[model samples]
Target: MKDILFVNSRFLSQEITGVQRFSIELSRSLKRILGEKVQFIAPKNIIHSHIAKELNIIEFGIFTGHLWEQIDLPIFLRKHNSPMLLNLGNTAPIFYKNKTSTLHDVAYEKFPDTFNWKFKTFYKFAIPHILKSSIHIFTVSKFSKKEIEELYKIDSNKINIVYNAINEIFKPIKIKNNQRYILGVSSLNNQKNFHSMIDAFNQIADKNIKLYLVGGINRNFASTKLLDEIDKNQNIILKGRVDDKELVELYSNATCFVYPSLYEGFGIPPLEAQACGCPVICSNAASLPEVCSDSVVYFDPYNVQDIKDKIELVLYNEELQNELRRKGFENIKRFSWEKSANKIIEIIEGLK
Candidate 1:
């Protein structure tokens, strides 16, 4: 049996961010199907100590300080000597000769202004070389597949679209009755466009209906401003950094999920909401449309009034909500970790 080494940062062990969840679930799915055919590698000093134990995984860590991460990832990868390397996150090692790396999206390339300066600079400097060396590249959505191929001038055939699977925990739960609140789960970054979301919610003008913001608790860019918005409007609730259980609880009870992001790679939040039977109102931009489709009500992400209008329509119309629920359940069939793992294994076996 060939050895497959899964490589990623501490997220594999800590925090349930979209990337972390994707890597962990994919790894678990691989282990289940490939049994004794794969080895998971990651930094041992992750923020979530219980994650590895909960998942029943053993990981390895390095001791060269942070320098090795940027400078010696390729060397460290070589030392491990695994036949195949899977990079769940960006920045694969330079010296690795055969590898399949995931470029979740060409977000930075598509909208450079969405990312901070350091990340943009690093991507401009490093991604081309990584692309040149990687034999196969996987993305989370068809939107990303096309973007990467066109932007990087790579063959469309070289880019594989392995859609992300939703957690079964996000499946429909009995939503609390008389729950008149709109929900949003996203990083408090410029790309998320939470500022625009706040402006839209403020226009709702109904004190009985509140707005809840999940994620981005301590983040500097949007937290302070978000708090200020909440202070002025007591109807806005900032329930920051919730765990999986709490997130599912929020999803089950929310009136609807609003995702007015300027752009996204795959947009997992809408799916999570839909899985929990929450009607979703999302922006018609970037990969958002690709992942959500007719499963949600589409709005012009840049227009705050459009967001407000969609939010009101979904919340007021029971028939529309029921229809979206049906569509959401049907939409979930398009993704599966089993299929994704098999594809990865197929590509690995095909490598000459």
Candidate 2:
């Protein structure tokens, strides 16, 4: 009998973001460790067919999207005698009691204006219930674990930290490129602080170096002046949503990768850059310092001048860039999908 049933509602309908990426990678790792003991399930409407096939996910339920998650999924679990459910995504079926769910961060609670009213309203209602009902809670970082406890009054012992790691595809590649460019990757949202990064990039004295931002804007997020700002600068190139192969290539060739986000549960891009032998210049905010350690050149995300200075600090100095690349390579060894998955397995086994 399958001991754990993975709720893959996020895989069916949602676009791949950091949260979904965590779910996908963690689920893959869990499957490898658990073998036939875990069963993965998803809704009928699927957006990621490649991922769906690779995981050998079982599709069920008449409803799609949130309806499938809330209504159809719970009913299916009940039919199976309510086996222990593992929800790697931020959400889980509210009514289900025998489940462990991951809450990536309290970004919605901390930065309310970053998300739309509808998204905010649903999270406000759902999160509390998910926290209350789940048998256990999982988060991506120590910072996020603290936020969830303080914000929701959750017990410290109930939450588990499962760090994210870069996939093997994001390793160092010997790609030849002549053009000089800096890289930034993440959704163009208010909390990501892309506007500040762009403003900082504009201040750089070198006109030859270009800034390439790779990510698409989510409509559910509150609209920003990013598009208008991007139009004013010719040196800034926005490469909307790229494949993993292309992203690895971009990271492999970048002068340095910059991540200027205001907050993160556990930032993955900087580590991905590290895995690709690219130096990192990152924001010294949220969980970045904890995840990045001494692997990156830190700058205040809110300060455009600091961002510019740090970018130039790594970009111009070949020695500092090489040092950061070396540190990054060492730092990435602290996290791995298999390691995190084994922790989760131990926790589940302990509960039994």
Candidate 3:
């Protein structure tokens, strides 16, 4: 009999954002550690067939998306004697008491303007109940843990911090590129502070140094007024929704990677850039300072001039860039999928 059931509903319905990436990588590590003791379950409509096949996911339920998660998933678990459920994505079956959930951040609560009304309303109604019902909660950083505790009035001891690590594909590449460009990766949204980053990039004195923005727009988020500006600027390139290999190449070749996000559970892109031997210029906001530590050059996300200054500081200095790359390599050693997986196993065992 399976000891744990992984709610993989995110794989079926949602695209791979930071939240889904957390679930996917953690599940992979858990599967390696737990073997047949754990089983991954998802709805019948699987968007990530490659992932489903690798995980050997069992498809069930007539309903898809949240309907499948709320209705069919609980019913299915009930038939199986209600094994311990693991929900890595933000949401879970609200009524399932035997579950452990990973809530990445309280962005929806803190920055409600970033999301649509329906999305905000649903999470506000559902998340507290889910946290209360959960056996334990897992979040990505200390910043998030404190936020969750304060916002939901949950005990600090009940939450676990599982830091995100770069996938093997993100490692430093030996290839050389003559072209120079600054890189930014994340979904296009107000929370990302892309408007400020764009403005900052525009003010950069070097006309030849381009800025490449990688990622697609998330519809659930309220759109930022960046498209018209992007169209007007020739130096700013938007490479939307790249695959892992392409992302690694972009990171490896970038003169520097700039992340101007106002808030994060634990920023992953900076780590990915670091793993590819790229220097990082990051906003010292929210959980980013905790995740990045001293590895990245810090800037105020709200200040366009500060963002540009930091970018240029790293971009122009080869010695400083190399030092950051060295520190980044060292910083990355503190996190790994396997290590996080082992921690989860320990927690599960303690419960038993």
Candidate 4:
């Protein structure tokens, strides 16, 4: 651990979302286990200042954006002669040699319609090179490991499967049940399938149920063109990015939680919904099945009608809801950020 440094480009370069949360939570967990052996470095311009303040991050880099990651990071690593550069985010310096990087998913390539051309094109070129160059590749799920191996034609042995756990913050709270709404949280991207969810919500016979989209439209990326579509639907409310406390409230008292993502590396929200004691209704495609297992009611992501049917079934079925809630409690015990952090250190030490 003497010559190792954790790269914090993604932490500074972007806002605190699921991805940045990964960097923060994992860093905290790793710090507890490894003590001061773990250190961090990032750029100066950070969006999530409160979260960043918690970590002992050395903020010094010439540039900020993509150039900071690609050029500035690698130069710093070279100057320090770092033995291992742990890149917790999906992208890393393509030139860095002795480093491990985590690839959350390859959704952009598989679902090009979900992303703008700029976002897609940058990843298409950067990820493959980053994966190939890294000493070890870490992914969030078995589904993602297989996807990366199949797409990049890399040896499966090189990619480590580190599961993403529900943050401890998402506990069941004794909040007043004022709202009877179905909850969905994700960036307003095409692959999130929020539009189809709206269509599905409209089909449901239950006139009383309202659908809430929790995450905001990401202005950093090209607009998903969903604001108008969401605006048109009266029952649908866009809560766009809430604080952790508010999010837990939304999760705790909802009638149900819905995750209609078309694809994911590891579907953390379903596990989150489960942890918060909300019954999960999610897509049967990609990593959702692998992550949620028997705990969630599944629907075909491509079929709007299928999503509708599943949501309705979960809504009215008392026995099914109770059973899902039980199984969800049992299922969440399998993933731990502490365990994940330990495994990550083992991989780094093993490669060394």
Distance (Å) between predicted and true CA of 208, model 3? 0.5
Candidate 2: give the clashing pairs: none
Clashing pairs in 3: none
Q: Point to the candidate with the largest lDDT.
A: 2
The TM-score obtained by model 2 is 0.97
Q: How does model 3 score by TM-score?
A: 0.96
Candidate 4 achieves a global lDDT of 0.82
Q: How many pairs collide in each candidate, listed in order?
A: 0, 0, 0, 2
lDDT (Cα, tens digit) per residue for candidate 4, span 1-352: 5545565555755766677777778888887777667767787777766656666677767888778888777777777766578888788888878889999988888889777788888999988899889999999999999999999999999999988897888888867666678999888877788878887888899877789888867665524456776777788888988988988888888878889888888877888888989889888888888888888888888899999999888888889888988999999999999999989988888886
State in Å the error of residue 254, model 1.
0.9
Candidate 1: tens digits of C-alpha lDDT, residues 231-289: 78878888888878889989888888899888777878888888888888889998888
- Deviation in Å, model 3, residue 32 alpha carbon: 0.8
Q: In model 3, which regions exceed 4 Å deviation?
A: 1-5, 174-176, 218-224
Q: How much RMSD separates candidate 1 from the native structure?
A: 2.4
- Candidate 4 lDDT at 93 equals 85
lDDT (Cα, 0-100) at 19 in candidate 4: 71
lDDT of 2: 0.88
Summarize candidate 3's per-residue lDDT along 194-307 as a digit string, tens digits. Answer: 999999999889999988999987654635458878878989898989999889999998999999999999989999999999999999999998988999999999989899
- Residues forming the 10-long window of minimal summed lDDT in candidate 4: 1-10
Model 1 TM-score is 0.91
**Per-residue CA lDDT of candidate 2, range 1-352, in tens?**
3365555555646888888888888888877877778788888788988887777888888988778889988888889998888888888899989888899999998888888888899999999999999989999999999999999999999999999997989888767788899999998888899989999998899999999999976655625467877877888888989999999999999999999999999989999999999999999999999999989999999999999999999888999999998999999999999999989888877766
1 against 3, candidate with superior lDDT: 3
